[model samples]
Target chain A: MRRAGVLALVVTTLAVAAALDTPAASAAASRLAWLVPVALGAVTLGTRPGALVALLAVSFRAPDILAGVERDGLTAVTFDAAGDAVVLLAAAVMTGSLAAAARLQRRRYEALGAVQRVLAIEAPLERTLRRVIACLDWRLGCAALTLTLRDGDAVATASAGCSALAASGNRDPVTREVLRSGRIVYLADAGGQPRPRRVLGAPLTAAGVTIGALVAERTGELSPPERETLVMLAAHVGLGLENARLAAMNRRAASELDTKIAAATHRLAEADRAKSAIVALASHELRTPLAALLGFSELLATLDFARDEVRRLAGIVRRETARLARLVDDVLDLSRIERGLPVPLGPRRVAVAAALEAAVEIFAGVDADGTGRRFAIECEAALPRVVADPDALDRIVKNLIANAVKYSPPGSPVGITARAVEGAVEVTVADAGRGIAPEARARVFEPYYRAPDVVRGVPGTGLGLAVVKALVEAHGGTITLDSAPGAGTRVTFRLPIAREASSAAPVD
Target chain B: MLAALGALAGAAAVLGGHGLLPPRAAALIAVAAMNAAFIATALAWAGAPGAGAVAAGLVLAASGAAAGHPAGAIAYLALPAWLASLARGGRLVGLGLGARPPAPALLAGAALGVGLIAHLALTVSRTRGYGFALGPPSVVLSSLAYDVGVNVPCAECFLRGALFNRAQRRWSLHGAMALAVALGLARYLADPLLPHASEVLAGAVFYVALLGMGNCWLFWRWGSLVPGTLSGILLFEGYRLLVVS
Candidate 1:
């Protein structure tokens, strides 16, 4: 629209100058006024067109110059005409140069605005790519435009204004050169069937990686502004592509966050439910033993009872109190471990054989009924002493022996074995009893998790194995349990040998 | 105890001179009384020392204004009170001096409309032969400077910042709004230009009261004195532009 206004202005100015050139209307002052339109034309239309208008104005003044020659002389008329020509040419040159500079600045501003608009588009990458291609095609007057994104061993192409120019393979020579050199490449003519007369390729790089290429084709050599604009457009396209990728990643992260929140909420609810169950069960378990102790104590205080009855009730109270103490201790131990407090470890060199014998002796003393529960101990002679916390080791061995005896049937044998192997001490506890179910074996070491089948028959807090596992791991050891329903269970653990033992041994 | 003294001073200013007191004196009395009410309410409800200091500041400003002090002198009189209040180390929200996320577009549109209406009203008064003209450049400049630097801040701080916030907490919203209206109308009681019981007097009172209520609502909504002060300055400048002669 602006270009047409300038054209109309140029035409009107020329016609007015021509009308004023008539012999009846001729005046020297009016002739001088003709310079105004010539200057205007130069500023609006630039050097060449402005010079043409100036020439036309000079021609229109020829008749007056002839008349001047008649009135004065040829020499004077020649001087006047030469001076007029010089003034007109000067106006054209100066105004034309200024106009060209202004045009270049305006084009740069427009290019920046277009790039901003392209970059501001918040859409999927494919949609943004198509919009950018369309913008470039319209702004640069490209016959066709294509953007090729390189994925691993694959290329995805988006085209505007031409489908035949779509990339047929993972590579195009122009695009390849631009991507490899990280520079703009131009082809005078695309040398292929249905080729464009000119093509420009620029690498779309982001974060030091050439993610894609922008290719534009037209039917003539691109001007410098056009080439520069294409380069600017390619840079904006790279940024827009990066933004799209980041947006996609953000969306994925949000979805993942939602999933994690849901899972955490579920786990919290499950924990709350488990806590309620533990409270109910623990209260019932405590109340039952308390009722017996209270009832028997009340009878002893208020009524005369036989000596045998008194002794039996006293024994029952003693057992119940011991059970309550054990339960409290287990609860406190697990709480301390979960709170991440440091567990005390008194490290010293201790013989594994002596630890085993001591645990077995304690077990024998505790088996007051003496239903023939037996332990088979096997230890390698001359085994190097392991550096350990003695009390912790004693707890580990005693807990294993107690578990074995508690789970096995009366008269069944429990086995304890220890040996030094490959810079470590390995221990195994085997029991012939109703083994843990395959599904329950994995969870036996979980705090407060009792086997459903044995919980009703056995008197235990389900913390024995959990405590065992924790102590073993705290001492830089690994523990594993192998068991199946109706099959005997085997528990094995290994602890690294004391550093001094390994260092002191001579090389064989 | 300070609030009681401020209230007594306000009562003396309003009731002592009967109909002979100047309009400015009556306005100062109303400002002092409102400040006293606010301080009493805040002390009873929250025991906030900031409220006491703000009340003291308003009383000082009233005293200065009653003595025909310049706007800058009055502001200086109020500065110590503001400092004392700030040193109490409590949230300023209870005093309506904090920002809330009110709709910006709505506030801006309302401010523009209020400015235009004020200008139009002054122009109409000029056309009605009330003698309005653009004054000398000095008069215009001084009026703008005083409105921005003193009058808008003082009026907004007393009415919306302290009184409205305390009233809202002490009474129901409607009751608080009623208190604001009553205090606003009291400013016109001693004006000699509009004689007592005249229709013009009643109209002025109603208009001023409405302005006060609207600004209080703005303060409550935005939880800040800023919008009210900004609107007050705009209206003051517009009125000055139209009728400063």
Candidate 2:
């Protein structure tokens, strides 16, 4: 509507100028009416449009000037006519320049407002920057604008305008200089060709740290006020960008906190579930030995037996008692582990071969009973003594032998190997049974956990490996399990040699 | 080389214009030599295929001028040359032989032509009245035909296209533009057809400098010869309005 009003005013002014400059009114020399449209256009529209209107006004006097030239000698009349045109053009240009400056000031205000609006909204940093630059391209009327920010060690650039013009704006030397000097850099257009006439850059400083640059390339030189507005705009945008960055950082931090909380909650739930399972399993395991002890006592109290029978019954009672003691010890150790207490260890330099042989001798009876399960023990000669608890080492070897025996098929043999290797004593137990499934391998050492399918009728509680693992770790040793569903199972444990106490040479 | 040629061309034209030399023979030699020089230089620098076609337009213009029939066959030669230029598949685009002078530049060119003509109409109206309606349509068309077909292309392609682009690489873009504008100024002042009067030459210097700089600016900004060519055509068409005779 404003544009239409301006157009109407220009047209009305031109019509009046035309009517007044007519032959009916006066001679062409006395006519000064044509200056009306020139002045109006200049005050209203600005330089180029006003100049065009001035051109039109001059054309209006052309015929009169030619007629004047015919009556009077051509030179004087043409000179007068041309002189009038210059006056009209000069008036338009002068007024137009002032009008242009006012218009530019208004535009810069609007551009800053638009940039601030975008910065006010909650949006991604890059998106906000792009919108700000787009406003400069539109409202501030730059040929190209680029906002470059430092993203850690990399730069994030958002550009607006012709791709050919703005694509390299981030890399422009003016932008680099602005960022380096932390001051405004102005590159005036040099060539007469129409390119970005002025490249103005201001460093985007946030919290006294120079982050990057805000660059604008324009086709015309800016007024002082417009330049001031640009400096102020850059500062506002710098703070906006930094604020956006901090907001984004906070968002990421909150997301990570949520994930960790969820993970910790899951762990707590898992621990509660394990506690319930441990109680159920402990009661079930204790019932077997307690029922045996009750039945043996009942037999002695209710029945009269011969002398040989009484002796055998007594031996049976003694063995069950010992078995019950071992089970109770395992339960106590598991409870200690659940409470997060370190295992009690009496570390001493112990012979690796002697410990392995002693643990295997206990499993020898199963091999002797014509159970196709067999033990093949191999100990390296002159094996180094390891700095480990003698009891923990024995327990580690026994637990591994038991796991091998349980997993081995009737016809398969369990192999045990102990050797001094690379400043440590290494022991391995192998079995060729159905083996553990890869999925269950991780949880096999966890208390009361077992592979469901493979351990269908397998005896004994699942505390064996867990207790062995805790004891071995307490003695400064490492244990590993390698198993597959069909490919058998292997467990290896290594303890560091007691180099300070003894050498790697055989102590045998 | 361009500075020297522009100076030599200006000297020959000034001498011929004042009757110090034969105008017809001087213009003929200058036209032939300028065209030949452009062709040789283009062939030497990049062996541009468009050079061959544009040079044909130039030589035909030279020959037509010698025969006093500049508007005859030479005017129509722009057709085949423009087609051949299109068929070269954008290789010449880099050499400023293509035609994409953007919307803004085209508008600026038209405005520039109008501005220069307005200035001419204001300053030179006493001595040389605007000959627009006084001359035959054929005369105006003939002059415009020469500009469109031969003069605009050869001059724009050789001087602004090749020379300005090369100098921009070696020197500052502003310095190169200034150099191109200078050579363009010299070329115009040296034309035998330019009026042989001090007042007329003074106006010519002012207007030609503007035209030269404007054309160089058009070529540089858009990297196209089309805007300058259109402006050249309009400029010469306006030139035909002058009643120097």
Candidate 3:
């Protein structure tokens, strides 16, 4: 309404100016004050309005032309009026075209700005796509807008201001063309079922890859600015889609990181709990023997006892001190292995039979006081030598024999067996004693873990089996425990046979 | 007492100087407030700084907000509360800055319902037109940024963080809530356009009071400023779109 009022006012001013200038204007100078309305109309409105103004300006000169014809002649007035009309018309057309182009440029600027706004919203891909379609439809004044994205072999379509594209049954030719050419395609009179009068399609490309196409449909042919707007919208849609994909990937990565962190936290907590339990148990174990040793030695020192009594008290102290010493040595050895400190091993050919016999002699001497425990030795002829540290070999044999004698019934025969099996030497120490329960077997190798039933009345640190397993693995050998309750126990191990040197004789 | 006085002085300075200062100076003040609050919060959390020092930091932050950075005001206000909670061996939730899941869910639903209803009323009254005109993208983006960053955070800080939390500490919960409602209404009353006639005054008071009380209740029930802030933002944005344009 305001625009119409302004146009009317301009026309009235032009009419008044033309009437005032017509009479005073010389024949040489054509009265062209009428061109003002034409130029103004063309710049403010479009070509049609500007043309109407030019016609009005030419008609307003009719009265002047008639007066001129009465006073002068027909040829001069006709030429003057005709010349002014032509100039006005030409100016109107030129200015109108420039105005139309400027308007389109302004619209294009607005369209780009709107696309930027749509992209700024950090929404999911589907939501962002829907918003982008809405934005394009509103900004371009289109009847309908659609976004079709390529999903592998299939196309996923989303639309605004219209029903969805006829599902998979109907293919859109414009969309297909845009996707194929990777360029903008405009369709005039898009003639298909559910056809639009006009359609503009632009390819949505991201990082140099043609991902999809954006299509806008309208009831009339799109202006050049509208088509350019569609192109800009498509570019931003491609960028928005990439951003959405990156956000989803980041979310997935964060979720995985959270899971891993939770798992690590749980493991650390469990380890801490186990360490605390071990510390508590170790303190109790150490204090009990130390208490006994101190009490007995104090009693032997302060009290004047009879000869026999003194001997008994002194013996008790000796046993407790030995137990304490053994506990300390076991702890030190386990710590060394755990810390990855090398244990001194003198690798040499050691006769297994000689080590076993010596171990048996030591066992017999310890039990010589009274408790009758018998040992039976069995060895295959030409038994092979083993490559081992001699002292370690001696300790291994002694520990096994001691365990066998301790667990067996009085007078039970503990067997020591050695046999050559393929390239390895096998040794077994069997005792007619209580065997380990199945449930406790797997965990027996864990440090400080003791079987409740086995530890009752047994004065042995639970570190023995744990240390044995570590030592065997250190030598690249393996050990196995075969036992059942009331059926006795058998411990077997295999060590690779020592390779003979070319210049050295085999030890028998 | 000194911390409270400092806070009051800072708030007065910001409110007084807001319209008087040039845009560039206001912006600088806002940035300085944000940085001061951030640094103070970090130090308090990492090294257990004294309460006096934390309070002083918050005072500086409040002055910054007064200088026209509403978002910075929220951070500055929140830092002091967080520091106080830490000194007391309490949690942020205890001071109404964090929410449990169920509370937030319930509050969100309530906020949405209220916002929608208010928006519809405003639209029917023709207070403003629907705001979704095809405008320059820059204007739209800037408006949204102002909504989320400046308006929402600043309002939440004033009502929930500084006003409600401080009142609750000094008085009973109900008393603190009454004070918050009064303050909220006082803000609306301060607007020059509000009808001064008695008949219009009652209705205006009732409307502003209800909004204020509802927001305060949301803060208290959820044990956080988040729900209340979100509710305020949703309602404000909805109103802007449907009515004020």
The candidates' DockQ values read 0.00, 0.07, 0.00
lDDT of 2 by residue, B1-245 (tens): 44455565677677878999787766855664565466435533544555554554455455555356634635445533653464366545545655555798788888888877865666456434544445776666665655665566667766776787667644555677788888877777766556776655666675677677777777767766667767877876787777754
* Pairs that clash in candidate 1: none
Model 3, position A184, has a per-residue lDDT of 86
Arranged by TM-score, best first: 2, 1, 3
After aligning candidate 1 to the native by TM-score, how far in Å is the CA of B30 from where it should be?
99
C-alpha lDDT (0 to 100) for residue A94 of candidate 1: 81
Model 1 chain A lDDT-worst window of ten: A188-197
Q: How far out, in Å, is residue A111 in model 1?
A: 15
List the RMSD of every prediction in angstroms: 32.8, 9.2, 32.9
lDDT of 2 by residue, A45-138 (tens): 8875677677666655654564455547458657878788788888889988888888877776777778778877888767777777877777
Task: Estimate how well candidate 1 is docked, as a DockQ score.
Answer: 0.00
lDDT of 1 by residue, A354-458 (tens): 999988986775574588678889999887677777877887887788788888888788999999988779999999989999888989998777788886787
> lDDT per prediction?
0.66, 0.70, 0.64
For residues A291-399, write the lDDT of model 3, one tens digit per residue: 9988988888898999999988887777668657766766877898878886666677878888888888766755733666788889888987887777667656766
Clashes of each: 0, 2, 3
Better of 1 and 3 by lDDT: 1
Clashes (candidate 2):
2
**Which of candidates 2 and 3 is the stronger one according to TM-score?**
2
Candidate 2 at A241: error in angstroms?
Answer: 3.7
